[model samples]
Target: MSPQARRDQLIALGLAMVGERPLEQVSIDAIAEEAGVSRALLFHYFDSKQDFHVAIARAQAEAMLECTAPEESLGDPLRILTASMSAFVDFVTDNRSAYMALIRGAASADPAMREVFDHTRSVMAGRVLDHAPALEIEPTPVVEMTVHGWIAFVEQTTISWLTDPLITRDELLAVISSALPALASAVGAVLPTAP
Candidate 1:
């Protein structure tokens, strides 16, 4: 395989293994074996096991961002947001294991891992802010903070749903969708009113 392909293969294997279990429980040996490569080969692609885990974490974060990104073709902001929310629900439902591993596993605590998590949250918040004009709201600090909090709520709700799935996916999506207007209203309540 080409060098890039080889590297991608290792990362793919790592992600699969990590998805199966928590990062602390996943073995580097198993990852290498699954990739049909020697442990040394895996090490060659990544300086250390930590680097391998970090790479997988980064990939997972990027995948989540891609899944939630709004389509530019959608002219209506509400339609765009709805589409993004639907994509987010589908991605979490399909990648439950990987999503759990990334969000609640050891990666949650590692500085490198936290960097990716923080970046993803910031990106999501920025996307919401980008739609402020369409939402008829100013992108004030309160709105920004509300968006961040809403993202956290989404993450927790996803984790809970993945664990038990007590509600239907459509219901879960409705619950999430219903929160946007309330969050915007909450932000509005906090903003100073004109004299």
Candidate 2:
């Protein structure tokens, strides 16, 4: 297999095993055995466990992007946001383990893992900018900060929902919907008056 393809396979294998375990419990050996490759080969593909984690981060970001795709082009901004949140909740529910690992590891001390964590949020920020242009006020840094905060909120809430399935998708959707006005207000507050 090509290097990229092999890397994807290893990432998928890692994601599969991570399905609900904490980040610390997961090991390179487990991922290597799961991928049917030796530890050396795994290391060859990725410089370290942290590097392999960057692969997983990109994969998770890709998955999130996929989930957002369907609702991204909707005519109504509110509907688009609602659909995205519902999709987000569903993805987290379906990939609880992987989601947990991705979130936790990205927040950890490893620099490589942290980069993925930051990059993944940045990818999501671009999407938010597209969806909520009002947030573009106050220059790029402010916009990015606001977008990152929104991403963090989404990630935190989704994880909370996963901890208790009793929180139905509709309930989460309602909460997300309720936030739209506040998000709009904040975005609008920062934006300058149109000429």
Which candidate number has the best TM-score?
A: 1
Global lDDT of each candidate:
0.80, 0.72
- Please identify model 1 stretches exceeding 4 Å from their true place: 105-107, 193-195
Q: Top model by lDDT, which number?
A: 1
Compose the digit string of candidate 1's lDDT tens values, residues 101-153.
66763346578777767787789889988998887888877778888888888
Against the hidden true structure, what lDDT does model 1 obtain? 0.80
lDDT (Cα, tens digit) per residue for candidate 2, span 135-183: 3343345555666777787788778777765677788778766664576
For all predicted structures, in order, the TM-scores are: 0.90, 0.80
Q: How many clashes in each structure? A: 0, 2
